[model samples]
Target: MALGPIQFYCNTAVALICGIALWTDCSSRRISNRLILIGLICTGAVVLIEVYFKGDWQNAGGRLAAGGFASFLHGIPYVSGQMGAGDLKLAMVMGLLLGWDAWHAYMGYYGLVLGTAALILCLVPAKHKPWSLPLALF
Candidate 1:
C-alpha cells in the first residue's frame, strides 16, 4: 500500500500529536488532558473532511470503529496501570487515521512500533526511576 494524500495527512497529524505528547510526558512525567483533547479535535476534523469533502463515506464507520477498538484495547492496559492514558489516546488516533485501510495497515504499524519499544526497554538497563516510553518517538 502506497502512501496517498489522505494517509499523509493522517500520518502528519499523528506525528505532530505524538511529538507534543512526548515533550510533555518527558518534562512532567505526565500527559496533559488538554493535549489529548486537542488531538481528538484534529482527528474529528480529519474525519469530517474525509466524509464530506472527499466523499469517502464508505470508510467512515470503519475509521470510527478502529478508533473505538483501539481505545478499548488500550484501555485495558491503562485500567491495569500498565499503560499511560496518553498512549491509549494516541493509539486511538492512529487507528482512526489508518483503520480506513482494508488491511488495517495503521494498526499493524502501531503494534510494530509499540512492540519494538517494549523490546528495547526490556533490553536496556533502567538505572533511574521508571522511564515512560515516549510514544511520539516511536
Candidate 2:
C-alpha cells in the first residue's frame, strides 16, 4: 500500500511509541501506563485529524472499531495471566493507528515481525546482563 500523509504520520508516531515500549519492556519487563496513555492520546488526535481533514468518517469509525477489537482479542492473554494489560492497551493504540480495513494485513505483518524476532533469538546466543539504565543518568 502506498503511504499517504496521514498513514505516514500514524506509522511514525506508532514506531516511536513502539521503540520506547521495546526499551522499557526489555529492561524492566513492563510497559508503562504513561507510555500507553500518550499513545492513546496521540491516536485520538490522529483520528480527529482524519475526520476533519480527510473527512473519512468510515475510516475513522473503522479505527475505533479496530482498537476495540484489538483490546478484546488481547484480553484473552490478560485474563489467562500470560500477558499484562499493557500489551492489550498497546495493541489497542496500534489498532487505532493501523485501522480495521488492513487488520488482516496487519496481523500477517505482525506475525512476520514476531517470527523474525524469534528466529533471530533462536539463532543468536543471548547473554543475561543487568541493564545499566541510562535513565539513571538523568
Candidate 3:
C-alpha cells in the first residue's frame, strides 16, 4: 500500500519512537511508559486528523478495533510474564498505524527475527543470556 504524506510522517514518528524504545530497552532492560504514551498520543492525533479531513470515521473505528484486538492478543504474553507491557502497547500502536494486515505481516517478520536471534544465541553460549525478547525485537 502506498502511504500518503501524513501516513509517511506518522510512520517516521513511530520509527523514531521505536528507536528510543530500543535504546532504553537495550540499556536499562526497560521500555518506559512515557515512550509508549508518546507513541499512542501521536498516533491518536494522526488518526483524529485523518477522520477530520477525510470524514472517514469508519476507518478510524476500524483502526481502533484493530489496535484493541492486537493489544488483547499480546496481553496473553504479558499476563504470562513473557512480554512487557511496553511491548504490548507498541504492538497496539503498530496495529493502529498500519492496520491489521500490515500488523500481521510485521509480527510475522518480528517472529522470524526473534527466532533467528534465539538460534544464534543458542549457538554461542554467553555468560548471561538476555531475558528481554522485546528488547531483542527492537
Instruction: Report the number of the highest-TM-score candidate.
Output: 3
What lDDT does each candidate get?
Answer: 0.73, 0.76, 0.75
Per-residue lDDT of 73 in model 3: 78
TM-scores of all models? 0.75, 0.78, 0.82
Which is the better candidate, 2 or 3, if ranked by lDDT? Answer: 2
* Candidate 2 lDDT over residue span 35-112, tens digit each: 989988888888888889888899899989988998887888779876777777888888898788767776787678
- Residue 73 displacement in candidate 1 (angstroms): 1.8
* lDDT: worst 10-residue window of model 1: 129-138
The sequence of per-residue lDDT tens digits that candidate 1 reaches over residues 1-138 is 577677677778777877887788777767777877876787788778879999887677877888888788888988998788777877777667665563365556767988987787788777843555555443
Stretches of candidate 3 exceeding 4 Å from the true structure = 126-128, 131-138
lDDT of 1: 0.73
Off by over 4 Å in 1: 125-138
